[model samples]
Target: MKESSLFRYAVVGLLFTMLAFSCDSEGVINPTPTPTPTPANERFLVVGDSGTILVSDDSGATFQAVTSGTTATLRGAAADADGHCVAVGAGGTVLYSADSGDTWHAGSCATTNTIDRVICYGSGKFVAVGEATGPDPYGIFRSTDGGQNWDRYAVTVTLRGIGARSDSQFVAVGNVSSLNDSALYLTYTTGASWTLYSAPSANFPAGAGWLYDAVGTSGGYFVAVGSDGSLYSADGGTWSAGGAVIGKLTAASWCASSSRLVAVGYGSGGGVSKGRIYYASSLGTTWTEVNPGTIKFLFDVADDGNGGLVAVGAAGEVLYSPPPADVHDAGSLWYDGVSGVANELYGVCHVP
Candidate 1:
């Protein structure tokens, strides 16, 4: 109980308390903070006939089949900002997936005809285009509630392709009637109305020109591909000839991150159905063909958003081409016809 001893004891106790507080109070050790993990890059969904779907996590390097609850042949597909996707196919069949591309459920727009194309335009907006088997239904439909309900447009033509610039503006490409001529449809009022756009003579050759697919670029430019060649619309109307691609181009998509546009389809060369991809640095400009070295028929091409591209085509072939414009060096085959399970892939879209 001496004064000096009491002072020493009090100082020791204070030092022990300070040490305890510095190392997390209540004897709880603080863990080293871990930085948040970077998410997986480049998700994609490739859809094809017989309601088949293949999903990829690393761009398009690999794929696995996901269950789609229908036997209807799917043609076109698109994904939203939140990883939701909608795919359309024959007999007005629509499939929607909430968890990226894992599982899909059926959705409809009340038509027995085929739904050729579907696009997700962010903010819970979706658009689908196809022909009507009968006269009672329109060719285009729109959904605002994440594809839960659809509102049909008034136009009466078979729509093959569709794209949206924003939540309200959209462009569709297809046949005006059962005729073999090309047609372009535009809507600024979402889906309330549409107008068929006529093109001036860029003088397409005297063949039955048909537009198969259309896409809206970043700067208000729209590019469409078809059996004859490629077409361009600077202001979403008043189309002019972009140029004639060598083969039948079915689908086109623009990559704003790399300033490239890729169009895909099949062509008969060397007496075989070969896949063709045309690449351009800018829209409405001349494009160069880059052979991915595949004889499979390619129907759709999409940008992977990481300076690369993924294309899907006949017999469920999913092709991945990396940057620096070397697509032939990177060929990862997703499907082959050896198993008797090959489905013709008609559409592909990047999952954000």
Candidate 2:
């Protein structure tokens, strides 16, 4: 070969060798690191009229429907730490979801009465309460077989709400079917046997007091909310007033992360009342109200397991509060977004 050509080839070869050495043997160069995706922060199960059940993997930003296997109106839902959920509603309707509410199947309790609320606290153990239109109507129920079947309790009052501190202990509250009668309050210490509790006549006047929901707190306390106000119990039996006169509180939840309690309901204004929300750091203490600016008839509220909250109400309206702190400001949380269903959303629950 000519000297000039050979010199050029030698130079090209030297440049190629330098470039090859600069990179790894595998030929990868300055590769950008792939980012790890964030898993879903929270999962939520929401049930409403017409047997509607929706799941929101992204907090409450969006929702997808799950087959509920019934056309009855679903009123309340409950979940354990593992995300096993049970929902109840009209006509004694009971639905169970083993996979964090992703899918559901119908279950029977051999009653034609309406089940207003349900709570699952232990493995295959569930408690529900509601009213009935037929014989032996108003009372509570117990299910040891994971909602596959249930056994009705002896309490004859219209039980609106129920909660369990453990598998063996539970508290339920409600009102008499007759408006003139007193509220129906009771507690279960061990099993089938339930002891009745009478609220202070001064605090819960007859015909005016109606307890709707009760929840077990991580702090080892139970708080039952109602139209007259809130009641707190160290053990689920003896109760005292929580002194919250906000309005007709329908539901309350205990947020263990923040050690706070949140309650939701509607104001008792004359006609077409607006929704209301209250928060308390301690039971039997004064509760502060949260103003959402816009009015909605909120029926249920739950802790999001992220220090925030989720509430559902009329017209499938959902409200979500952010995590790690205060959301009292009108716009601090989000609302007014539609859930695609026109039916009223009666209950909401969050699964970690």
lDDT of 2 at 348: 87
- Tens digit of per-residue lDDT, candidate 2, span 1-352: 9999999999999987776433222232322222322324578889998889998876676688888888899998877766578899987788887788888888777777888888776766778888845475546777777677778776657788876667777877787666633354455544476776654454443334778988777667877888777877787655666775546888888776677778888875434357877777658468766554346788988777656677899877887765643533212244443477778999888875
Clashing pairs in 1: none
TM-score of 2: 0.79
- Looking at model 2, residue 178 earns an lDDT score of 64
Off by over 4 Å in 2: 1-40, 132-134, 180-185, 188-191, 199-208, 268-272, 325-338
lDDT of 2 at 76: 88
Pairing residues by index, what is the TM-score of model 1? 0.79
Q: What would the TM-scores of all predictions be?
A: 0.79, 0.79
lDDT string for model 1 (1-352, tens) is: 9999999999999986766432222222322323322323588788787778888776676777888988789888888887578888888788887788788878768777888888887656788989855765678888777666788765666678987666778888887565677777888887668877643234333453788888777677777778888776667776666766656888887777666677888776545557777777456468666555567888887876655667887776777755433343222212221212477888888888
Query: Which residue pairs in model 2 clash with each other?
Result: none
Q: Which ranges in model 1 have alpha carbons more than 4 Å from their true place? A: 1-40, 198-208, 269-273, 324-341
